[model samples]
Target: MDHAPALVVCLTTVSDEKQAEALARTLLQERVAACVQVDAPIRSFYCWDGKDCVDRELRLVIKTTRERATALQQTILRCHPYDQPQVVILDCSGADPGYAHWVGENTTED
Candidate 1:
């Protein structure tokens, strides 16, 4: 809907399920994310420090508000195991009105 709340979608990868759970919980507890969906056993290919790398990872799909997106990202960076964790933020415009409202309501900061 054109009148939908301003939502934010973020993506990040964790090395394992424990880490995925911890980070997800932190984001939610901090009121930075309304929802965090974890998908596991995904193959990731990349290069770090000029070395080719391939590994299995869990991907977290995070839903938040534009206002809380920064806090969510900051929390991920602070709590993530990797020195450089992947944190991607996307705009969520024109979403279903009910869903957008839920995300906004759930992510309000204290």
Candidate 2:
């Protein structure tokens, strides 16, 4: 059986749930992401501007193809309210064939 091309799952954190939902909606509407899942009230610990900090955040898991990854990142950066948004692209494997195909179909330019 032939497998579809791999998908990229990008992760980004936002200050609140509202931002998370807005970002997810924009990405889906723009076709930059096939699907986006938002989870909130996550505690993140990181160093910023030479200071260590811990804060509550919402995480957005964005799914798309490698072809759309760059554009997706740019879109997230532009819409995000953070000076340095955490946009991590994860290489995905072993996805269900139908789901993978669906993602590709949705994320491609019309």
Q: Taking the candidates one at a time, how many backbone clashes does each contain?
A: 0, 0
Q: For candidate 1, lDDT tens digit of each residue in 7-110?
A: 88999999999999999898889888999999858999999999999999999999988888888989888889999999999997787789988898898877
What's model 1's lDDT at 6? 85
Each model's lDDT comes to 0.90, 0.91
User: After superposition on all CA atoms, what RMSD does each candidate show versus the true structure?
Assistant: 1.8, 1.4
How displaced is residue 5 in candidate 2, in Å? 2.8
lDDT string, candidate 2, 1-110, tens digits: 46686899999999887888889999999999999998857999999999999999988889999889999999998999999899999989888989999999899887
In the predicted model 1, the residue pairs found to clash are: none
Clashing pairs in 2: none
TM-score of each prediction? 0.93, 0.93
Alpha-carbon runs more than 4 Å astray in model 2:
1-3
lDDT (0-100) at residue 1 of candidate 2?
A: 41
